[model samples]
Target: MGILSDFFVATPEEALRYANRIEEPDEGDEIEELLDPVQYKRFTDLEITTLWAILEGSDWDVDRHALEYIEIGEDNEAWLNRFPDELTTLLARLEPESQAAVLEAWAGTEELACDPAELQPVVDDLQRLASEAAASEKSVYLWGCL
Candidate 1:
């Protein structure tokens, strides 16, 4: 069955959105532009750091091709689409907790630095270890989380 057939979202707009994925060929470029010079330098340096982190401890031998996904320029759908033994290798090397921690660290260092606003919480009951200072203010709350 197709996605729309299985899902119960009310509008075509919603269904189409669920079917779509965010394309970020120039996502890094945008990030770089929005950041100040020092921030941009930090961002680039972090990219190098993420590159090495994904490289050195990874389970598989990810080639120059797969590394493009982590990079900021050019469409990388071709390499990203097909199933790779490389992904299996990468996942096999790390536990789910480790994976989440690594992602959290990277996102916190780079993505979080760009937006001082705050991160939308993963779960309300999941317990964030931060003060609720801004949680009372008007801001975005992603509703799709379980």
Candidate 2:
């Protein structure tokens, strides 16, 4: 399976704590328990950098605003990273049509290579998540399990 990724909103401290705890294999159940109350959107297989480029209307560049590492599992197969506040802000400001355009662009990326129609719900969830995060003055983070 490809990476299982969740984009969620949380305060910096809470995110750090969650990130740290999520790296522990034994804490999987506890982590699931904690996730019950969190605000999140699942976007499997979409890398954070690719999402950022879609929002910024730019080409994919891994080096562009490198994701801030929160934690990495000992096996190096699982990790957490934060999206920049600027990206969050940009995503929040996009209108529905703009959001659709971004989704179209993202679908066109070689890595995604899928029809934009298939991503409508993903874009909708992202727009809502970004808006909520911005309103609450929280950050968006990626928790990825490879």
Give TM per candidate: 0.24, 0.77
- Which residue pairs overlap in candidate 2's backbone? none
**RMSD of each candidate?**
15.8, 3.5
Per-residue alpha-carbon lDDT of candidate 1 for residues 1-146, written as tens digits (9 for 90 to 100): 11111111112233223223234445534432432111111222223334235434543223432321212134332111111233223423444345455555445554334332222221111112111212322111111100
Output the lDDT of residue 84, model 2.
79
Which residue segments of model 2 deviate by more than 4 Å? 20-46
Sliding window of 10 residues with minimal summed lDDT for model 1: 137-146
How far residue 52's Cα lies from its native spot in candidate 1, in Å, is 9.1
Candidate 1 ranges with C-alpha deviation above 4 Å: 1-80, 109-146
Task: For residues 1-146, write the lDDT of model 2, one tens digit per residue.
Answer: 66666667777776655666655666755754654333333343344568777787687676675777775547577677776788778777878767667777878877677898877766676667778888988877777766
Best by lDDT: 2
